[model samples]
Target: MRSLLARLSLLLVAALVAGCGADASSAEFNGVRLEQPYGVPDVPLTDTSGASYSLKEDREDALTIVFFGYTHCPDYCPLVMGSLSAAMNHLSEEDRERVNVTFVTTDPARDDEQALRDYLDGYGSEFVGLTGDLERVVELAEPLHIYVADGAELPSGGRDLGGHTTATLAIGEEDEAVALWKQDTSALEYAEDIHALLADD
Candidate 1:
């Protein structure tokens, strides 16, 4: 688990290090910019509401920020979600309405529909939760540079999590990935970045 966290840490630092000059004219937050745009895969999955939906079908007007994590994560998952919750609150009512935060679990075996609903409600009802084929989930996240690491379950029952990346991917109005926010990034910075995206298009 520590190794997984370390991997995410290094990737984020690398991203922050790269593309620093690319968005200097307008970027309000320090996040890695992909060399090429990545579109959300049309992978089929079930939302918390049990309806059929795909990331590709989410709103085009809204800046969709997707996090690939599990509900059972002892620390990182909740922390990132909390940051998003606070960040969402900071947006103006108009901008907030244009932001959609979706949580897609890397551990579909455990994050059942009821569990997802309960877990996401802690952040906000507006947050969407999706749980389905782990492989499909991986396919959806791989291009964005997010992958899951499933550690062995402890004797007590909960499994250790391992994921290659721990960044919230912000999809732009063009439906292409624009930024990657590390898990520990401040809520205020997230709010600012979201606003910046809205201002751009």
Candidate 2:
């Protein structure tokens, strides 16, 4: 699983690097603005309320930022969420209203509705959380180039850390992903890029 995560991370880095050249001329974001924007994944999943939710059909904001991760992830997940939270803090009330953030769990077995809800509330009440069948989660992540896989089991009768891509995606008004941020991107950079995207929108 570690090897798979490493390989996926490398592939994501390469993809971002390639995307940089594709949109460099009209660069308007701190994050990589894709030349060929991705269409939002339309797969079905359950929201924190245990109700049906579809990313493509249910979004109500002009911009939606999505991240795939699990609550048990010891490092990257929390760091990215914290950065996003800080970025949200940097936005004006009106600007914040125009944006939506969604966290999709890669390990649904351990990330039930209540767990997801509790975890996300610490970040922001408005942040959405999605979890369901693992296969469905993988299907939802496929088009976005985010990988997800199970890991080995631990001695404590539990599973080891799972494999998943750490990149965060920014979907625009037309349900196309306009930009992506790497794990290391700072909160201020996200704030600036988000403000620019909103201005352009």
Candidate 3:
């Protein structure tokens, strides 16, 4: 009886270990899957200060979040930025330092150098606002799967425009977009995702 009990106990222990390993491999939070391998493309952009920035160069040993929206976006732009700010507030100083948040305006005409700078100033200094030549902007937007339609006919004097998608991308250290968080997602959720990426070895 003792020998049989010992064998059963070992089997139970092995089963528990296997289950724990599976759970860890399938780690997820708030319905967001935490395991995926992807990357962001290398694109050249001009910052609000007219300085050139390449996605490959700007990427360091941290996670970078990129959002494509114009300054004139009445609802989405500010809301997303605000949520991002809130999410940053929840992170530790080290994690915050390991994260780069960029706001790229699709409307280069109105969101000129100074205009882009001023708009991002309302957020945080760490937040970078990038806008460059229209042609370059279109080229950069293509690979990201973002489509911006010229909406010069809406409220507020027909300055309204829409994009193909309202999504923010999370780029890992290798310049690859690891995950995409939609505009409707909460800041806390965004923070969690960033934390997960940071924790990944």
Ranking 1 against 3 by lDDT, winner? 1
Top of the candidates by lDDT: 2
For model 1 the local lDDT of residue 91 reads 92
Better of 2 and 3 by TM-score: 2
Instruction: Compose the digit string of candidate 1's lDDT tens values, residues 25-68.
Output: 44545566666878777787889889877778755456888888
Worst 10 residues of 2 by lDDT: 153-162
Error of 2 at 79 (Å): 0.5
- Model 1 TM-score? 0.79
List lDDT for all candidates, in order: 0.79, 0.85, 0.75
What is the lDDT for 132 in model 3? 77
- State candidate 3's TM-score: 0.76
Off by over 4 Å in 3: 1-27, 30-39, 149-163
The TM-score of candidate 2 is 0.80
Highest TM-score, which number? Answer: 2
Off by over 4 Å in 2: 1-28, 150-164
Q: Candidate 1, 117: how far from true, in Å?
A: 0.7
- TM-score, one value per model: 0.79, 0.80, 0.76
